[model samples]
Target: SGTAVLTPREPGGLPHGLRAAIALRAAAAVQDEELMAHYRARLEACPGGVSFATFAVPGTMPEDTRLAAILRHADLLTVEPRGATRDDIEGLKAADVTEPDIVRLAELCAFLAYQARLLMGLRLLRNA
Candidate 1:
């Protein structure tokens, strides 16, 4: 399911490269090096994925307004999801992000968070 999220059959407005970059960003936010490497590999496999590579770094923002909006929303969802508001959606819309793409972004972020937590739990158990 996570792989599907990253590389959907019909990726809509979000391409595979962008999806990998977003997933990489979320993984990086949690400081999960292994997960980061996983996403990095996926990103490398994607055509033109390197253009979206900046997003993998937590603080790096894009010059493109639409991409900047996406980075902001991805950061919010990854770092502090509880604080997300409708205004964030409005911001994305203002940047020309379509409604379906917004939903796709949310799903990607949510799945990465879940994957991060699962990885953390497994690490803790292994050391226990």
Candidate 2:
């Protein structure tokens, strides 16, 4: 039997790498200790590398504290207005994501890819 490959339904949305990174991070946040241990064990058994972290519960903590914790763990942080338009990009350009920040983002992307590959391998092994 052969598995069928599905084509994308849309274009110019979030990248696959970014989506995978988001999913991996969310999975790490599962609160069950048994599940967490299972993930850890599977990750260790897998050939590729993957990393996991438990994100702090939101709203239960102060906004600044939550932001700080995420910043400490995140490789790249994206910020967009709740409702933004083209003109908003200009306004945001001056205030948000400066040149040095972009450079840092590139590095973050690379690191995230490495982590995703490791994690994906582990997840697959677990499913197997």
Candidate 3:
């Protein structure tokens, strides 16, 4: 069977703040009406998906914040220890990372987190 492609809906250019909130909610697997409404509103505002593409001379905060948020919601965070320079981060911010890149990065981190979480859960699942 072919793999299904899931594209992120554009959220009407909503501010990153709101968009991030919606994304975090979705990551948490929370399907409440309010969350859906927020996502819908953002999508209506930006039909082309949140401007994952930015040209603001790539600052650390946005990427840092996004990474932190993902870690918070994801079951695992994985670092490959590749040599990353400031320019790399800047480029990442400016370039539109292909959907495949995003998916791969997310999958790697999630897998790492999941494995760690599985072990932790096994040890603590019953106590809590």
Report lDDT per candidate: 0.91, 0.35, 0.38
Error of 2 at 92 (Å): 5.9
Q: If candidate 1 were superposed on the true structure by all CA atoms, what would the RMSD be?
A: 1.0
Task: Give one digit per residue, the lDDT tens place, for model 3 in 1-128.
Answer: 00111232432223343333333334234323443454455444543444432211112124554443333322222332244344544454445444444454454335433544564567587687
Greater-TM-score candidate between 1 and 2: 1
| Per-residue lDDT of model 1, residues 68-128, tens digit only | 9988999999999999999999999999999999999999999989999998999999999
Candidates by TM-score, descending order: 1, 2, 3
Query: In model 2, which runs have C-alpha deviations exceeding 4 angstroms?
Result: 1-92
| Model 1: per-residue Cα lDDT at residue 88 | 98
The per-candidate count of clashes, in order, stands at 0, 3, 8
Name the lDDT value of residue 40 in candidate 3: 51
Sorted by lDDT (best first), the order is 1, 3, 2
Q: List model 2 lDDT by residue over 3-52, tens digit each.
A: 01001232122222322333344334433344345445544443332322
User: lDDT at 2 for candidate 3?
Assistant: 7
Per-prediction TM-score, please? 0.95, 0.29, 0.26
Which residue segments of model 3 deviate by more than 4 Å?
1-96, 125-128
Estimate the lDDT of model 1.
Answer: 0.91
